[model samples]
Target: MKYVVAWRERPTGSAAEYEAAQKRIREVLALWKMPASLTIHQFVARVGESGYAALETVEPADLQYLIAAFAPFSITVVPMMEVLDVAAGEPRGIEWRNGLPCTQP
Candidate 1:
C-alpha cells in the first residue's frame, strides 16, 4: 500500500521542539513493520509551515502503527493505488491536452 502522511507542525514552537517531533516520527516509521514496500518523499511546503511525506509500503497495517506512534499529534494517512497509465517511467500519451495546470497550450 502507498500512503501520503502529512504532519502539521506546531506554530508557536521552537526549532528544538519541532525537531523532536520529527525525530519521533522517523523512529516510529523505522520500527513499523508493514506489508507494502516503502518509499518516502517529503513534500514541499506550501501555504502553511506543515510538512508531509508520501510513502509506498507493502503492509497496510503500518499506517495504524504510525498513527499510534504519533499519538497526540495530528497525522493523516491515505492509501493510494497507482494508475497504470500514469505509472512512473511510462510514456504519457498526447491525450493530455494543453491548458492543464502545468502545461502550455
Candidate 2:
C-alpha cells in the first residue's frame, strides 16, 4: 500500500530550545537508516523545519517504526490512492450520491 508521510518539529519555547531540538533531530537523522521494507518515492524538506515523503510498503509495522525513530517530531501518516486509480473504479451504485460523476449513467 502507498502512504504519505509528513513531520514537523513541535513548537519550541525559545531560540535555545529550537536549537537544541534541531540538534536532536539532526542526530536522529544521522543515526537512522531507511527500512528495507519500504520503497521511498520522494523525500523532501521545507525550510529545515518540516519534512514530507511518499512511501510504499506492504508492512504496516514500518510506519510504526518510523514514528518511533523520529520521536522528536510530530508525524502524520495517511493512506493514499492515486487520483486516476480512484477515477477508474467501477461506478456502479454511485449515481444516487450527489455531486459525483458516474460513468455508467
Candidate 3:
C-alpha cells in the first residue's frame, strides 16, 4: 500500500524553539526509511507557518511508527489508491487531441 504523508507544523509561541525543532525534524525524516522514488518537501507558500511532504510505498502501520517517533509534531496521513484502468485508452478517460494521430472516436 502506498501513502502520501504530508507534514505540517503548527505555530509555536517561541520562534527560536520552532526553528530549532524544525531543523531537528529534517534530520529525523532523513534518518527514516523513506521511499526514494517519492516526492517530499516542506510547504513553500506558507514557509515556517507550515510544512508539507508527500510519500509513497508506505504502510498504514508505518504512519503510527512515524508519529510516535516524532512526538510533539502534528502529522497527517492520507492513503491513496492507484487507478487501474481496465477499459481504457486513458485512465481519466479524457482526450483533447486536435491534430494528433490518436483522436477520440
In lDDT terms, which candidate is top?
Answer: 2
Give the best candidate by TM-score: 2
Per-residue lDDT of candidate 3, residues 1-105 (tens digit): 555555567567797988888798788878878434444433333454545555554445656776777765777777755566334556345444443585558
Candidate 3 ranges with C-alpha deviation above 4 Å = 30-52, 85-105
Q: How do all the candidates rank in terms of lDDT, highest first?
A: 2, 1, 3
- For residue 6, model 2's alpha carbon misses the true position, in angstroms, by 1.4
Q: Residues 1-105, candidate 2: write the lDDT tens digits.
A: 899999998899999998998899889889899789999899999985788999999999989999998888899999998888777763544544655665784
Whole-model Cα lDDT of every candidate shown, in order: 0.65, 0.88, 0.61
Whichever of 1 and 2 has more TM-score, that candidate is: 2
- For all predicted structures, in order, the TM-scores are 0.46, 0.80, 0.50
Off by over 4 Å in 2: 93-105
Each model's total of backbone clashes: 8, 0, 1
Residue-level lDDT of model 1, residues 1-105, one tens digit each, is: 667887675443788877887687678767856444556755554574565777877766766776776674677787666787356524444435443477546
Q: What value does the lDDT take at residue 101 in candidate 1? A: 71
The segments of candidate 1 whose C-alpha lies over 4 angstroms from its true place after superposition are 9-37, 43-48, 85-105
Model 3 is weakest, by summed lDDT over 10 consecutive residues, at 36-45
| C-alpha-based local distance difference test score of model 1 | 0.65
